[model samples]
Target: MSGFLEIRRGRAPLIVAFPHTGTDMPADVEMRFVSGWLARKDADWWIDDLYRFARELDATCIRTRISRSVIDVNRDPWGRSLYPGQATTELCPTTTFDGEPLYTGDGPDNAEIDRRRATYFDPYHAAIGAELGRLRAVHHRVVLYDAHSIRSRIPRLFDGELPQFSVGTNDRAACSGALADRIGELCGRSGHSHVVDGRFRGGWTTRHYGRPDDGIHAVQMELAQRGYMDEPADPSPDNWPTPIHAAPAIAPVLSDILSTCIAFAKGKE
Candidate 1:
């Protein structure tokens, strides 16, 4: 229970991980950024709020308070690109999704990057592993839902507008194909465009922790921000993030997605 980590224990065989919802940046870290807003722009904006209902399902929820700009907990610790030859942020990113530099001058050196990993990244994943171990002890099978969201259009990262729901199971290696199909089916019924194993086929968190044969099923849900937020073509402070209440139309879909995960964990899917 470090200052950077938040965990809610539950008896259910489900763990909902919020890896990028954090916006906090230590003063020293924030000082190096070009702008406060830009540093926080690419965060999984309001994702924690979008999935706030996870608590009601008696699902274990773990999140981080430190911004991903400091160190991306979802990235590979050893510096291997999740998508080789593709543009993606590093474990300790120095730029925004739009290719804007986040630092004033020089970014953290290799030594500093290692320190950030030890200080922040390690504990966050530790908490996740701890929660999973605790739940797997009681349940015959457990599900790890690595929740995330992004702007619908990031030309630097993808071709065009992303699907409303981008579900990933590391190409059926992270979890059972049945679980992924069930979730994709629900997304299709929600009337929202979706793709399985699309551009974001899950990040390091999904790849590292997922071991379906060991009874630990991991899946990553990368939602397009437009599905739940008022995404202006050019977002500024005034209109960048629409309030959570404004996304009522999509709440039922998110709720159904999570419920489906729980049902799958309990072998009811």
Candidate 2:
């Protein structure tokens, strides 16, 4: 266990990847940021807690403690845009989702970016790959559920209000259609707004690891923060996060979605 990564092993053939729930920014790294809170504003806030029940299902949980502001593990390390011609952050983001500059001076140089990749990014993916190998050896198939969450409304990122659930399998190339459909169906049954392969069609983690032919399926679930937390129209330090509480109305639905993922991995669904 390194200072930046954490892995909880489970006996099931499912691994939940939490790449952006971290808030830690190394002291030297923080000194370069414009605002500490803004650097973390776009994080998948409390998603780890939101999916705390993953352990009960015996699903392995792999997470990073280093803030995404330092290095986004979900992005392509080669610097290819995930969404071509669209506005998005890079592997080492220079700005927040809102387009605010994160660094006081020029952002990370090429050397610094390389260092971050070696120190933080590489290990995170290594852990995921290692876990996948371990699980695939024991189970006929394995599922990689990349968990994430964002504000309900980010005009800079998407138009108007976003759906409560944004499911992505890299446009159906990352996982089997059956698995994707079942998860979408469960979300629909929850009566929450949802879209498959919508604005967020997975990320580097999903696209890089998912290989249906290899018996490894990957899917990304991007949840709207409003679905689980109190998101004020205008956020302030006092009420910005609103704490991490299980939204009485949404917890059961999320559980059902995760349960479906485990079932898919076990081929019981």
Candidate 3:
């Protein structure tokens, strides 16, 4: 019933959550974004389509339809940096991923950011937590797959290019060693470039909800946008449009990853 967030219940113990696939910009907030200020360019395009296997596998899913430009559901509410010393966006981003300013003049200040958190960020996280509780109540163990994607060659975010599959578990603290090792080995065997706890060592979602001791495990999968799409040279309104579709070639790779995750959770359960 909530437009800000959506949770699809599944029978499987695994949950596939897409926190960055949202593109909706509230009316009041939309005007705040100056025309061609690059707010829409930085969206995590078609991440939900990448994880369509969730529904097929009967995997629970918690997603937010609200744009990250409104409030990053993956960020820490305490304002802690997910990646320190790195140029990362905040709860309410001030610019696009390509370092383009989003507002001509002053945008939302401290008070506004806090209000958005209460309205969007807090509810989004609460949905995740509630879904985890729901799944755990049915299954012995529940695994959360925090899904995200970004442009592969964003020099502002990282040098060179991002690997196809970027896995993170907060340096193996978020889940059992066995689970992490299994996923890592599976990813490597799939012939895709995969890294464990590399630049994306999970986010607030994985760090906060991952409690192996409590029968809840969390892991983040950051994929390069190139893995699923032909990223435009410039991701903007004129160039990159809405309903960003995922390429068919990447389906098997992602489905394989999700299947592996489900197997791992079943094993743990």
Winning candidate number (lDDT): 2
Go through the candidates in order and give the C-alpha RMSD of each one to the true structure.
1.4, 1.2, 2.1
The TM-score, computed over Cα atoms with residue i paired to residue i, of candidate 3 is: 0.93
Candidate 3 all-Cα RMSD: 2.1
What ranges in model 1 sit over 4 Å off?
none
lDDT of 3 at 98: 73
Global lDDT of each candidate: 0.89, 0.91, 0.81
In model 2, which runs have C-alpha deviations exceeding 4 angstroms? none
Model 2 pairs whose backbones collide: none
Q: List the residue pairs that clash in candidate 3.
A: none
Worst 10 residues of 2 by lDDT: 241-250
- lDDT per residue for candidate 3 within 178-257, as digits (tens), equals 88887787778877788999989999999998999998888998887776677776666666744445455656777876
| Candidate 1 lDDT tens digits, 122-194 | 9989998899999988887899999999999989999989999999899999999999998999899988899
Error of 1 at 31 (Å): 0.7
What TM-score against the true fold does each predicted structure earn?
Answer: 0.97, 0.97, 0.93
Sum up the clashes in candidate 1. 0
Error of 3 at 208 (Å): 0.6
